[model samples]
Target: MSDYDVIVLGGGPGGYIAAERLGHAGRKVLLVEADALGGTCLNVGCIPTKALLNAAKTYEHAKHGSNLGIHTSDISVDWTELQKWKAQTVTTLVKGVGFAEKKAGVTVVKGYGTFDGPGRVTVRFDADGASGSGPAQRAESYTGDHVILATGSVPVMPPIPGAKDNPHVVDSTGMLAVDAIPPRLAVIGGGVIGLEFASLFATLGSEVTVVEMLPEIVPFMDAELAPMLRKALGNVAFKLSCTVTAIDGGSVKYTTADGSAEAVEADVVLMAVGRRPAVQGWGAESSGLEVSGKGVAVDDRMRTNLPNVWAIGDVTGRSLLAHAAYRMGEVAAANILDPEAHRRGEVMRWGTIPWAVYSIPEAAGIGLTEAQARAKGGNVQTVTVPGAMSGRFVAENGVKAPGAAKLVYDGDTLQVLGLHVVGSYASEMVWGASVVLETELTITDLRQVVFPHPTVSELIREAAWAAKA
Candidate 1:
């Protein structure tokens, strides 16, 4: 017999949400987290980076708000104060997680937990820290009817020389905690993470150069719109279709698309190539759980090969977004509570997911990309409209940094296939965008949904209007 109904092995968006749902549903849950309560998303990844980005955005406004008829002088960034504010923000959220777990009656064990064997786990408690609700024990074993693995991913550094073991090199986590912005920052990948950092440091008076191996940055982004974003990130230099050959102290050498070589000087190099599921130190071999190419394998209900064993979030390597993990957890938790009474509608659906990159000109997308739609052997039609077409976008952002909204639809059926938006409020439009696509709503259906006036969200309707035209 299992000691508990559910035992969550990580406290990320997936793990915590699963634990919360299980705990509230009257299931005995023990949440084991080696680090802080919120895991990487709270402690290092999303929240902290957004904090720095907000500070950078504010600094940009003060320095460049002259065109907005605002005059400001001597605007500066106090790295120390900014770091403190970021830390406080993280602490507040961590404490909230603790409170939530307590309120929901979840016993949170502060320690590194690993699979001891089937239906079992061993946790090594921290002697100096007290995240555990129960009395501390250096080593203890717990058995559960089911286990949910939500161990998050870590930044990946490429195979280039000096990418590691170099004092000047930093990953996403290290970049967040940097003492000061480098005067010359060379970002070795131009995906979301790299561009976000490039945007942050570039706006903070740093000369930022982005080097990407792909022909274009933001690889999976809408093809036409990605270049516009590259243009919007005007201050940062981009070396697309280039491979980083080596990182020799304070400089990065690269080979161009034509095989020509070039180099750029840098004070710091950020390796934001991508992230891989953290499958290490989790006792995978001993547990006998199945692991796929990159992460733990899971099914539609977020179930693994082992009976009643589930995994979610980046650990699944399915959808890396925090929101994706939350939805995955919701589905898993429902299925875990009662296998026969699983929430049918809550099954994890990949296409319904929305994505956002928090850059100066934010990018958001939902459903299939235009290419994906065409690849499905369907008659696809797409409408591309400027952000300036929206009254609020024009009024608030002016025409200086205009972004676009594009809707990809089935020309034969008139069903919306995808919606992509970029600009000032694009980051805030994903949830509503997701709802429209998730419901498989068409132009006729969308036309009936009234959008509030003078809002950037109207760009959705505007793009839809153009799609059917």
Candidate 2:
């Protein structure tokens, strides 16, 4: 039996970050992880997907450089090399996580941890970490003054007929490491995951189709910006308000919004509906942890109903994004270290959390949409600026590309309530927008902030000026 100041279960963004913070704060910490250190984001999810997408983008640029007067011949994609690069990137980042943990003086235990009691856990060592050259591994009991759960989430594999039996049907994880790019790909969801994969394959010469159940893709995105993003995703077909009925081998059958049955023939079908929190297993019930269908119930401070217990990141289902988990971990560590400040209302800010989709013409937004602001029933106003309005935007991506910035404001106060952008560097620009929203910077205040001349970010400032007009 061992005891520690803090014991963190799961090594995803949330758990690892919380452990690092606590360890750095001079608390004895134990981090238990059964898999790689960086978890899904650095392993199969965000990191690998972005690496492939970046390669696809480079390939597209090389093949279509005629517009920029940079001609190239024999441009090609080598899948083997692409996979190797992604693997190397994942390896480096995972090692980096371990190094950070070591630097923070966190003792890492490789195992599956289950709650044995309020402040206790039973860890069944991973196969590689087992001892004594025996088939039966070792299980150890440990106690902590405080425990944090950050188990993360898994992709939702909905029960559609023939989906499980069909080899062509693959979830996000499976789709990431496919044998080769299918000539025709049928994506079963139109959210960020599906749309990103669609962009990646479409750029790599796959005939792609995205079928979404909702009226629009990316349900959280601004209604006005969603269509613009869809338009920006060139050569990808989108079928909105559609429901998947079944998978017939390589074909996907679904119902259209008009009450008609339809099927898309493809060499592969990607089941990318979404992810659900991994609330089951690892002893939530035994520990009396309150968990809803959504996820482990937690307040803004990442506190659970149980004393000295906390949950963060996707496990809380507050936000599924990696960046969101990072912030949650910070808040949780702070609260744990300074219970006095935590009791004084140090809570996580749900608003001002930015989101981005890293497609070819990336899309990102922070704060409320126009409709959301209007629904709040106060004086609301919005202004739009085309991406071409910025000289830098025109110099890089021609005027023909789909690009725009929309600013939603509180009319009475002239305070910028929301900022959304669709076009190049949209992802990079949204963080600054989040800062403006976080600090409650009004349009007038934003006007005085000198933006570097000739940048895509200037488009947001332009939209701010237009709001006053």
Candidate 3:
């Protein structure tokens, strides 16, 4: 009676990963996507933004290479050529996903999918919409033993006046596809999306201004490191504890914490506020899946209240991270293929996950911060070490780039509770710290572990040693 073993309603990381796993297991799978295969991450969010950031970093490095004993002349950026390269880079990755789905023997469907009761899904093909490389699928009804709702998210465009119908206003997607860099840019939020763009544009000679409603940018990160990162990004102007009132043409008006009204005039206004799960506009209301204030309610195994229905990624609003989605997909699929997964302890939880913010000097951390540790009323010893102590950081970033690493450990148990780092290559280094936190390793245990010299990762070991003091 079922059309397939599983029906995936998205093509994002969570959806595709589930489909791939399901397909490879010899279960019939149908992956329905309305747009590109790789979702926001590959087509718009992570891949393109990182490409731009890398390009900006390269330019910034060349501009300041005199201290490193290297010099170049006539440094510039051809925006059109850069965009072309970005497009090609995205295209290649998308094709790779297509090949992956094909190799997994999954049936690819291109259309808008919505819930059609408990175990059924109705996919509606856009009458005249452009389709991705996947075969165009007509309106079809699909019933499955299990359904994965991995619809991902959409930018939270808050109701600010003139935000819509304005040429200067842009979201994260539009920000990435800018035809030309504006001289002055106003970013509304100071979260990951806002700050990342702020870092990208400021490096490329844009006068960037970040207005954050929170007391500090990257509120989810270690509080101490947040201010340090702001200071490191000296070029970009930051107005913290500010709330935007509206978006006027080419300008953003905000209210400071002190009730002072201020407006920033810019060529472009970026609404980098946040993202909400893409759960609306679908037939979910008609379905029996329980929707909560958070998002679609799902258990650790990603099962919904409705039988045979599951949700993952941003749609569930569990973590709203791509990596989290991947894990959620894994848990959801394992349960789908083998319903006894929960009995076998096959479940996903947010355990010591690594978090990263790619500013000029990137910031990444895992586990409890010092403040978080102290809040728990435990005796904690925390050490903040300069990344420059690592020979690689000194040689690569030089003395001017302020980079620091912190290790938070329990004074009683000697267990490492957290690791936070802000500097060059922080993103690349946080996962190693996550392992220490996950394993709950102690200072003595870390000391026994040898680290290669001249690498910034050595700073972790250095901090471990210092935490002893």
Candidate 4:
């Protein structure tokens, strides 16, 4: 039996970060993880996907650079070399996480942990545990003053005939570890995962088709901007309002919106419908933790129904992004360290959370969309500015490239409610927009703020000036 100030299950972004903060604050911490230290984000999900996308983007730029007065002959993608680089990158980051945890004086246990009761967990050390800095015992029970659940999520596979046993069909994880780039790729689900892979393979000379059950892709995005994004993704076809029915060998069969049966041939098929919170198989029942279909229920302070037990990240089914998990970890750690402060301490500011899709032509949005803002029946107004307004965007991407910024705000108060962008640096620039929303910066306030000249981010300032006009 081992005892600590806190027992953290799952060393993903949320879990490891909370453990690190707690341990640094002088709390004895035991961080247990069944897989890699950096979790899916650093391993399979975010890091790997972005790495491949970045490589694809490089290949695309080299191929298309003739328009920019740069000419290169025989530009080709070396898949083997690319995979090696990706592997090296993931390895370095994972080792960095392990080093950080060790530096914070955290006891690392690489094993499967399950809750036996509140603030009590039984860890099963299988083969993965042999590599950890824990006891040699095959199984051990650890008790702590507090328990934080950050088990994260898993990919969801929908029941489609022939998809279950098909060798060509793969999930996002399988797609990431693909042995070779398929000549033809069919992606189901027009969400972030599907579109990103579609953009990647298409840029790499694959005939890519996206079949979505909805009328539009990225339903949460601004409706007017959705088509612009679709147009920006070159050489990719979209079949919206379509349902995938079966996977017949390398053919993906689906029903169109008009109930017409259609099929597309592919060398590989991606099942990117979505992911579900990993609420099962972690001994939630043993601890009697209250759970919903979404995930582990937690208040704004990241506290569960049970005393001294908290949940964050995908397990809570709140914001599942790694960055959101990072913020949630900080909030949970602050509250855990000062329990007496209660609601006065740090709490999650969900409205300020931002989301981004890393495609060739990236897209990012923060806060409510135009429709969402109007749905609230407030005095809503919106303003849009083209990326051409920025000298840097025009110089780099050219005037023909698709790029725009849209801002949603209260007409009466002029408070910025949302900001959406589709173009280069969208992912990098959305954080500033998030700060604008977080501070409730009005259009007037935003206009008064000086923006660096000749940058893509200046589009936000341009949009603010347009809103004021």
Which regions of candidate 3 deviate over 4 angstroms?
Answer: 128-138, 343-345
Q: Write the per-residue lDDT of candidate 4 for residues 210-326, one digit (tens) a residue.
A: 999999998888987888898898689999999998899989999999999999999999999988899887798667899999999999889999999999898899888999998
| lDDT tens digits by residue: candidate 1, 126-213 | 5675434565557889999988888888888778887779988999889988889789999999999999999989988899999999
Location of the lowest summed lDDT over 10 successive residues in candidate 4: 127-136
Worst 10 residues of 2 by lDDT: 127-136
* Candidate 3 lDDT: 0.87
Candidate ranking (lDDT, best to worst): 4, 2, 3, 1
Local distance difference test scores for all models:
0.87, 0.90, 0.87, 0.90
Q: Which ten residues in a row have the lowest lDDT in candidate 3?
A: 129-138
* Model 3, span 213-297: residue lDDT tens: 9999888778878889999999999999998888879988989999999999999999999998887866677786788767898
Alpha-carbon runs more than 4 Å astray in model 2: 130-136, 343-345
Q: Which lDDT value does model 2 have at 266? A: 95
Write the residue-wise lDDT of candidate 2 on 1-469 in tens digits. 4499999988999899999999999999999987789878989899999999899989988988999999999888888899998999899999999999999999998877887656798888645783223452778999999899989999999999999968999999999889898899999999899999999999999999999999998998999999999988868999999999989899888899999999999999999999999987789877789999889999988899999899999988888999999989888999989987566656788998999999998999989998899899899999999999999999988887889999999888988899999999999899999889888999899988999998999998899888863
Judged by whole-model lDDT over C-alpha atoms, candidate 2 comes out at: 0.90
Q: How good is model 2 by TM-score?
A: 0.97
